[model samples]
Target: MRRLVDRLRYLGPAAGFLSLLRLTAAAWAGDAPKGEVMKHRFETSRIFPGTVRDYWVYVPSQYDPARPACLYVNQDGIQYDAPAVFDRLIAEKAMPVTIGVFVMPGRVEAPSPGALDRFNRSYEYDGLGDGYARFLLEELLPVVETLRTADGRPIRLSKDGNDRAIGGSSSGAACAFTAAWERPDSFRRVFSAIGTYVGLRGANAYPTLVRKVEPKPLRIFLQDGSNDLNIFGGDWWMANQEMERALAFAGYEVHHAWGAGGHDHRHADVVFPDAMRWLWKDWPAPVKAGAGSPQLQAILIPGEDWQLVGDGYRFTEGPAVTAAGEVFFNDPGAGKSYRIGPDGEPAVFLEDSSGADGQAFGPDGRLVSALAKTGQVVARDVSGSQPPRILAEGFPPNDLVVRHDGGVYVTSPAADPREPGKVWYIGPSGGKRVVDSGLRFPNGVTLSPDQSLLYVADTRSHWVYSYQVQPDGGLAHKQKYFHLHAPDTADDAGADGLRADREGRVYVATRMGIQVCDQAGRVNAIIPTPNGKVSNLTFGGPAFDVLHATCGDRVYRRRVRARGANAYDAPIKPAPPRL
Candidate 1:
């Protein structure tokens, strides 16, 4: 018995090592075509100044200069004889004629010989941001465009995301995914191997984010092993499985392969050739996403989806539409407000607008707002006249909702050390009274369709508190705080804004998409945004059925079955401006 147990332990390690050798042999045997491996050393004059990198390109033999070829990007340098596989696949008519670019991480040489080389692998590969993607789209690809194929055919890459793919392994795998996740317009299909979707550098958030974010048009293939790393960061195998499960739950077009091996390129080596086939399974035909989860279908229209209205903003928030169906939003970080006119173009509305957080139209035809800088509830007439009149002051206001009776309730989040966050009601006469207290990070205040209850979203606690509205404009019977559900791995839902439709469904903009709660305080459905970390949302368009979401720097909208509440039901046209 003792001998058998000893033999089992040795067998495990011995088999693992042997498997690694086999994978390495396979990789070397599948070397790319000699002329296909074209290397270009260039300096990026625009971004990451004083940085240089080696960009490797592989143009398939069938590529024609007259017709643009599909593009594929692999981070962390080249891998697994990609050129050879691409040549074979294109010849076999399995994938479109594609141009593959393998890029090495940036490096800064040490000032002196004694110091070590300033390797930027971890910095560029591990951080959670769009810097790496920008390096590829803005710097690397353009340089590749100047090169020609061995046949002297000029290289022209397709700009459509449907014709492009990006992939990598380990930390590079996370970087590849971050690129597509940050800028889906550049690359859509993804191939990840032994992916570092773990806690090394906030990569573990992907699983939770997948479910919370509105599903992108990306098609992903994940490869991992049962015997992968189990260390301080996290279990790579478990994280990979979690990501797959979340993707499945969110209705993304995702496929994955699980194996019994450790953390390395060995499993990926054996799988890369097959992964390429699957990543490009469909050629010019686009990949379609599956219907969202049942929880999501309730709020989101089955056929309606997010459409990009505009881009290039410092920080977009507080999306609201005017009576003419034109949208308006704030770029608080830039200290400017913009309006999307009927022509679909953005123009400045207000500059230096007191750092507005939330904006809504009141029944009286005035723009009601929660100004963070002034900590006041103010109302600005449409005429854009003298300084706005303050409804109430002396509290750090975050969001506000106007009741049918003309009173306003604002959320005061805990910012200063001396004050705890509270919900206050401001009477029509500008009198203030505290309604509720002792909640966590109150934000996104709204009312029920019947005007009998108020909903307050506690951003940090994953719960939306419901309060009964009394006749005198006070809250009571504060029971049934609906808990916002999310995967255990994610950070607290960043529930920042709230809106409601005529059907009495309350839409709470959360980190994991918008949680839709019915009148009974039950989560009837979820409406995901195209991107994660949506800051706020509002219903717009002619019928008020279009949902506009403020996701970081981008703004997206989708049509829905429910119609938004008419905040300004009695439209009283603003008095004509005096000359």
Candidate 2:
């Protein structure tokens, strides 16, 4: 009933909407056991704020309160006769004892009949990002748990994301995938049929992002036909195929069924039972992340993940590791520096850091920093005992890199829009010279492993400029070398800080994640932060194999296959690229 009403929002009056429903017969057959369905209306949402919607709770007759039931959530209020299908599947022992929750998109009531009520379906379903996912986990799911069975059995939903599955059709399908994609720890299995993966919003970028970013543990089944919607937004048929290919390329456990139907639920209705069977095939077994592209495989080590090291900082930045393997990061907003000890616990290293933004460790064991608030560059001892030696000042520096010969290159982006950003090179004698200027926003300066080249991230563009570093502390042969990926919702890559590995690979901290590029400047892989916001990074640990990143208010570290190259150390030529 909620499904029919949701479709009527775009279909005008109820008399006409009822005509479309008559085209299809009731989807269930007598072979499937009749399961009980209860209708529900939801009016409270702190996430959506003042929105109302309806939902349903389908409880299989085989459900016993002895164990918590596995959860299956569907969008757009239950198509495909899911209650009956669950009845047959649970009775046959094909799937586990599950509770299904089908929810409708929220809508805010209008002031009057003539005024248009704001419809949230397209906004909630089509847009990208974590808002919709939060709505499900923080809002809807909690309401579903409050529901009691007809026999007063207390409802319990499994806490594990692996014990959950979600599915939907059309725009609802996109919403379902977004929920799983954003919170894979909460929903592991996805069933998307006739998904609006095209440019209805930023969802069109999913195929590309799925290929570039690290793979997550998800088993997805897609169903679409060739004759689906080819409207102004995008071609549904081609978009679905692209999604399948991207998932396969990323090494996900993906399955697809192609047919000759339209955008309606005709094809999905026919194959949903089979899809459910495959989605829950090997119950009680965990789904593992795939090693999809060789690029991701080259850098990321198996069985290692991003580990939380520190949290509760005002805003963490400037991750630098010492030769002894101690990881240090600064919370410039709080004017403090923290050190991650061998036991992975963070302790305050400096109580007042002058609000540093970028940092690197010198060969003499001092920490060099680009101080943003004081408009100064300074070096200080790792401990809080000594005073900082001022290197340079009077410029608003965003990031900086120190070289083997004690030379420093700093990026000072234009504080005012009317001015051009500049890169200042400080020679060994502490003489400051403007090596380059007129960039939109230069940031995250670093040197190549051999010290013969320099790289700078231009925050206003998708390109990272590379330059030949001359012996006299000058730069030449400047060109846009590394091409980074940006989000569709943003104009720039948001590249913040950069570092080079011993293999000459560069990692740029961007809004999308950390894009790892080879010597030839081609992005090979993207490693995302645990919270989806990455700023500055450096390599740490005894072997320099641990990549530590300053992500917003927290700091995280992940052990990778590659080791880091320190600019302050002796220059070592890395192996040549594969052209």
Candidate 3:
């Protein structure tokens, strides 16, 4: 009886307070102009595989089929009385003639009635990656466009990301943000309420990742109460605050509203009308990507971004820059090599490149290639006029580096699992011999700026081996020098390529991105690729300041603050790194 009385004491005031707020909000929410709502069932999805979902489309009465309507997508089949709000806003000319898409999460039917149905809400919403974004851009929106009104007017959504907005509450809110974050070219404005930004999935990494990568053009609004969920995943209130702080720290256009309400939608519902006003204010102006953290700002030049230099390749690797500031990369899958000249255009340098995996420019201006398919080391002229000069044969090399004196060091990892990987040395006279053996999977190789040390990237481990170069063209005193950062989703560092700068810092291309490590092997900064996968990088351009990265199927280049060290040039001792 005492416990019951205590519950009543709390419930009584809370129920009355919420009811009063709802009564006050109902005045405008009901009096607002109305929009036509059409419902549809969608059963086909290759992305979610064997799932069905229901969706609703809201078209404002003022919408004209002559022009594409601005878009708004709300997950979880819509909340916050969005249709009425959109009706009022459109009627008042506060927002454009917008159409809203309310989509439910996908579900798979069970074999029997007693069996549990498979739910994809958490997988599609809480989980990270670009899968859901692709579904929306490639599947959902295209399907939405096929719909027509009762009068047979086709629904056309604005193709511009600036005119699109997405919002939701709880897990739906996370899904909305994920859609915008992954495909900023599709959705630019986000409105989140009581978002699931905690550890329910990989969303826990957003706060950390947002500060590291280049910012995307997005305007976001966040809302959470102090009394939100504090369960096993994480504290909801704190997570939203952390996300807000991270967005601000990374220079994002973000706003927030805190409240004393608990983990319910009542407060969010009350504030929905005003939130819409702020989110869609100053329409038609594109959202700009802000300058990220100071560390990122230090390396990335102003007004410079990753520009696409080449595409249509199966897999690109072996990015090498020459003294003339031209970039050469190999497409091992296509068995072709391409060169990007000073004009930033890709030209076919070599066809049937003997399936080269890594390449470097030799002291004589010839391109030295590590031929993996034919098990040969060859050097070819830049113009593709002469046949390749086979320097060595019978050993399949993964990556190689050439010294100014014409000595070459190559990494040859065992194809089979049982054998150990080996590093080879070929003297200027072409005498090939094993320099060292026993690395797990030796992949990318490079020399220090002074040519006194050699760095070898072990793909199967999170370590980069550093070796003192001996006078006899062999390695001595090898140490696991640079420790790399691996992604949480994978076991290995996936370190593929490495390059050295004039400041003695090594830029390692891993699953994470180009991790710039100091001389002491401490990672000072991580520059992620736009696609989150980078195989190799090289410094090119007129001043050797542009870092060209060979990502999957494409080549991207960006101007950086540091300059690359040329292996074919005379060695110069660099200044000591900061401790």
Which 10-residue window in model 1 sums to the lowest lDDT? 570-579
RMSD of each: 8.9, 6.2, 4.9
Cα lDDT tens digits, model 3, 1-579, are: 343233223222223454344335545355556778999988889999899999999988888899999999998897887888788778777788899999999999898989988989999889776788788888998999999988788999999999999998988888999889878988999999999999998788788777766788999998788889999999999999999999999999998777766787766776676677778888877789888888677678878878888888999999887888888999999899888866889988778887998989989988889998999899988876897898888888989999999998999999896799999998898889999999999988999999999999999999999999999988999999998877655778898898998888888999888987778887666887877779999999878999999999989999899899988989989998766
Off by over 4 Å in 3: 1-31, 380-391, 404-406, 417-420, 427-440, 450-453, 460-493, 510-515, 518-533, 570-579
Best by lDDT: 2
Number of the predicted model whose TM-score against the real structure is largest:
2
Off by over 4 Å in 2: 1-33, 342-344, 363-365, 381-387, 477-480, 488-491, 575-579
Instruction: Assess candidate 2 and give its TM-score to the true structure.
Output: 0.89
Q: What is the TM-score of each candidate against the true structure?
A: 0.72, 0.89, 0.86
Arrange candidates by lDDT, highest first: which order? 2, 3, 1
Model 2 over residues 204-283: C-alpha lDDT tens digits? 98998899889989999998887799999999999999999999999999988887777998667666777888899999
